[model samples]
Target: MDELTLRIYPSVRAAAPDLETPGLAGYAFARHAWLQAWADTFGAQAHIEPAIVVMAGVRIQMVLPLGITRRNGLRTLEFLGGIVTDYNAPAIDPDFARSLDATAVQALWRRITAALPSHDVVCLTRMPVTLDPPEGAVGERVPNPLALLPGVNAAGQARSVTFPDRYEALTGTLRPRFWADTQRCRRRLAEVGPIAFVVADDDAGMRALIVSLKRMKSRRWRETHSKDWFAVPAFSDFYDAMARIDLPEGRIHGSSLNVSGTAVAAHLGLVYRSRFYLLLIGWEADGWRRFSTGRLMTETLLRQAFDEGLRVFDFTVGEEAYKDDWANALMPLVRYDEAITARGRFATVLMTARDRLRARATQVAWLRRIVRWLAGRPLA
Candidate 1:
């Protein structure tokens, strides 16, 4: 027990200065490198604040990258990735993992929460259930996590619609009915004009596509009085940084699906871990909506991924109808907390109720139709 020393730092830049870190390419859209790059690009618009959960012995060792804040003087900790990051967890020291068990790791969270009181929300999201606790710890600090949605879209595993061994199993496995429709749509679109896979190999190219995506995504948000965080300076800087970093790291993989040399849809993703993480997306204004370029471009991208031998292709989070139809299957998600207090409990209750309602409604089509009707606005 005495062999380990604990430290929590205020900023990621200062957290693990000398530790052997994986250097930001791993998380692509949400890594610390991305955060810093964004800060540089937006010059203060980005929220670069990060905290680390570290345990050191003779020298600094394992670290858990995180974010924390004090709301109205109440201290709380949050996972840094938020909306932009997926597959997030603390990056532990390999040796640290060997030294600690599930109980001990749980104790670490216990210890960490005991230290912070200024923040009230001990919020955690997307924590895979298989996570282990550390040695000598009960994980008692963790608030019980609930399934993202109960049983509405159940009875299946999140298997690749195709098999891992061969690319054909997956791509060839797409809903045959949909594939037929897509073929017909593309044929009609081709008749209207030239359709293509436009590649933007430079910043200027990426910027143009992004401008289109933001313009399209924002139009819908504006009417609703809401905006994606990227619209803010901080988030935008981070995105621009994505373009600045070298390949397999900060590079932007943006392209357009076009007709008649006009961009009809855009696929905006980032390259990391030899796979592509789907990010912002958009379709051209009023140009052949019947074609479903969004879905077609997705099929094209997935085909490219398989052909390129990339193992995983994440659609990211959200329970959109299209995502459900195309992705292999839905995976359960968990929202966690280590030190939830009174107000936190109330907030959790509200959120739980909201999730349950949404889940129950997903089982029915009418609720969604009503929403679409109210939204009556066309897709932005």
Candidate 2:
């Protein structure tokens, strides 16, 4: 076995060339284009320091897209894409990933963390257990090294609907009543005018759909009094850049449900590695709400996924009830939280307590309602 060495880069753009090499298997979020877009948009607000780990006798083993952000005098090390990135794991060579055991992974992490820039705490979240190769790539799914770390806890779970051999089989997985309701909604929606599910195939169409998405999402956030990420210029820029990014393995996919030549519901997602990552979705909040355009759009997309022979329709990270209603498989996400300094230790303790309180609230109906009410969220 060769010795493993770590190198840190000031920005992802500087590391972009190295990351384009073949044989790397990971989520689209870990790619250079994605990370670079994030850095280009949020660099002024956050400090990005990407690290590459290599085997001395071999080639590049992993690329860690990391960044630091200070809040209330405490610097927190996190994955570069911040709130937008659903999954946070290194883009690693499959061979290198398979070669490591639990002990070796820990040792590698220790070396990598030691080389990271000064920070009060390291908080890595939404990591999956395995990294599957992209479609047409010759490799098996490999274990995610970060998920093997000791003391890692279940942060949350991502939901995905696995396609069956036949598209009709999908309905059997969902509640009969829910499936019927969607069909009813589809019929009602069609009664208004001609209904169609359209995909943005050109740059102009893509931009138009994105604009509609932002508008719908903005209105929704305002109605619910929720924090609107799209309102932030940097976050908006990052998403716009992603939608325009063109890559071989995967690219941003924008689609909408059009009725009488008007887009009423829209979705912006990624089609990567035979999976459709459902990232952003919004529906017009008008009389159309009674038509359930959002639900119809979801069903239409699932059918599209089946027609395209895609394997998974990933709902990304969320605990929403609608996702649970559609998802057949639940991918458990884990987190690695560590304190590097005295202040970090205190912060970690506080974080743990906060997590415990949140968990408790989830288990108690009244407490959960109160929590949602206080946060200005709708109680269902």
Candidate with maximal TM-score:
2
Task: Give the per-residue lDDT of model 1 (tens digit) for 1-380.
Answer: 44677777666456535323542112343345654553355424334355666667765545556666554333467665554555445544434544555566566666766654345567666654322232233332222112221211222222123226686676566788877897788788888888888878887888888787777666646755877665676566566666565542335578888777788888677756544667777775465578888777877777777776665666766545676556774444466654367765566565566556567677889876655564534222
Q: Please provide TM-scores, in order, for all candidate models, with all chains considered together.
A: 0.72, 0.89
How many steric clashes between backbone atoms does each model show?
25, 0
Which residue ranges in model 2 land beyond 4 Å of their true spot?
Answer: 49-57, 137-140, 350-380
TM for candidate 1 is 0.72
Q: Ten consecutive residues with minimal summed lDDT in candidate 1?
A: 143-152
Give lDDT tens digits, candidate 2, residues 1-380. 43665677776777776656556778888777777777778765665554444333367777777777775467778877877788988777787888888898888877777777788887888899888674566756778988988889998888899899998888987789989988998888888999988999999999999999999998988898998888899989987888888765887889999999999999999898788988899999779999888888888888898899898899989887889889998888899888889988887776676557678998898877766665633211
C-alpha lDDT (0 to 100) for residue 167 of candidate 2: 82
Q: How close is candidate 2 to the true structure, as a TM-score?
A: 0.89
